[model samples]
Target: MTIETETGSPEAPPKTRLHVDEPLAAGATVGLDHERAHYLRHVLRLDRGDRVALFNGRDGEWSARIDGFGKGWCSLAVDRQRRPQAPEPDLWLLFAPIKRTRIDFVAEKAAELGASVVWPVLTRHTDVARVNVDRLRANAIEAAEQCERLTVPDLREPAKLDQVTRDWSSDRTILLCAEAGPVKPIAAAVAGLKPGPVAILTGPEGGFAKDELDGLLKLPFVVPVGLGPRILRADTAALAALACWQALAGDWATGGADARPPFRSQEPG
Candidate 1:
């Protein structure tokens, strides 16, 4: 039986991509742990000499051949580089924690949308008390692997809204998705600003308390933008704001079909 990805398409056998911490260079050997070893050996049923892609965030991406495998581990020899490391848009997503499933969806989609950082901000209306940073990181890693991103978004621990805003960098602008306020249309707001370091902040499902919204407004870097007449859920608002930013002022404006070269498969020698 052939395994299919979420898209319902047959997964490419040789194009299995793994994010690893070890440096990838020609002739360098990398080892996988038991979990990954079991995945490749039993789940994928891959054998020796099968080629796989590896990325270490800093090393771009490399093709490697399975050199050895056992019950608990697998080793691969690095081949040549497939794609060089390239810069991504310095966009951040800051949101209040929501329910478990939605928060997970947010992390996954944020990675696919090219958020440079993912941060949880505790607001007065935020119902969720704790955030599993490990789980968020795992979701991000998996998303990066599936989406072919060179790097995973930097995940930050949960912080209070006041603390986050107080320590926020003046250089980076925050596009606050405000449900009620004096706001500019998202597209218009994005069009007015130059493409630079930016973050999108979405409130909780219950919305930010009045005082919280007021505090954010006083910040010079915070620019509240309106999505439209209709109110959106916390997750919807975050993603919609991000999509607008990317389409107007982020990498999406400049990236297209020819943005990068096609992936070329390498054969083991």
Candidate 2:
């Protein structure tokens, strides 16, 4: 088996990128599971010798060629590294779980928007009793694949808001999206935040209870921030806060290491 060299070319990258748990290195053989194998063979109709991209959280993205395929299984030969592993924003998103579809949307968008962690928080006003962490992880994985993210957001088990707050680390600031009470506008608040580990917390559709809000405000790490005068849905608030943070203080801002043009402009010639 021959190992290819990295070219750092301006051409477009492979469209099919998959996240796997195995290590990625030159000449390494990666085997796809049944679901992914089915996706490539039946759904994508890709054949042997075709190319795809693979990445694990530890290794950077790599180009790989289909070496062989069969029923419910496929193997790829790692060709070369494309992009080096780069630093990403250490931002977490904690929110009160909502309905199924909307929560799925939150998981997907959070991964795309550079959230390092996605945790479901149970609040007094939260209506949803159960959270499907596996489903959230799947959505995060799919979103990371589509957005060219090197790693998917870590999906945490559902925990009560009070318990999470009690055990929270003081070094990481929490920007709580408050619907009422004295709060600084999101834009203004994020602008003053120092670069470090941070998290965005959003309430459920019904909003946080008065006692819950009061409890959070008392915490030294919590900073209440308002979206606007108008009320936003649970999912909307979470994504909005995430986007604002990324734009203002996260990796989306100017002078970041991973700054680049949109994916379409880099298409292969």
Candidate 3:
């Protein structure tokens, strides 16, 4: 199944609805969880027998009928599955969280800009010790649904910067955004890099310590880059890097053809 965008339109055509939790299966009895039920019943004001489009990260999207509503459960009977869409590239965005509101903005934009994964790293200059994974997931879900994306970017549990880089893969390029120092332009750094997998690392609010910078720079595949002459906030740096990546190496230039890459499995069964 292929998720193709209508040709000849600069804007993304609207998708009727988006389902992320579970793929709609034909003749399969699927129940909406409590939160979803509230959203379907109250927020959306959707009633029984209404039609909604659903996509469960793995399955191609499908049209579903609201089977019934009673108690706390809302049932849906999936009918036909739409053509599957390509997932995002094997690109990941690893950065420290900014303030609460700005962090939320980053997650949302990352989803729209087509990041394969989002990693929240705790660096020496990080503002928050911990992050709300659930909130970030919600933001990603909404972004995917609204952007006509068939697959949602995976939001990994927050980890310390040191721990994440300890086992970093040599095949994947790591684009590190340095705020105060001169570095290669993002385009130059990404040029001709292998397309298999990549990551963008941005510093926190106050920026990285000299020691932290040295640690990252010592890594075999880390490529430090500058956003521009002016300083940007943590959130701005993240989104700018993502936009540059997508425009240069992502499917954004190809319409929706490159939007969906192969989906990444969460864990081994």
Model 2 Cα lDDT, one tens digit per residue, 69-90: 9998999998777777878899
TM-score result, candidate 2: 0.92
TM-scores of the models, in the order given: 0.91, 0.92, 0.85
Q: Candidate 1, residues 96-186: lDDT per residue as tens digits?
A: 9999999999999999999999999999999997999999999998998888888889999999989988888899999999999899999
* Maximum-TM-score candidate: 2
CA deviation > 4 Å runs, candidate 2: 1-5, 8-13, 255-269
Residue pairs with backbone overlap in model 2:
12-268
Give the least accurate 10-residue stretch of model 3, judged by summed lDDT.
Answer: 6-15
Query: Candidate order by TM-score, highest to lowest?
Result: 2, 1, 3
What's every prediction's RMSD, in angstroms?
A: 5.8, 3.4, 7.6
Reference-based lDDT, each prediction: 0.88, 0.88, 0.78
**How many residue pairs clash in model 2?**
1
Give candidate 1's TM-score.
0.91
* Winner of 2 and 3 under lDDT: 2
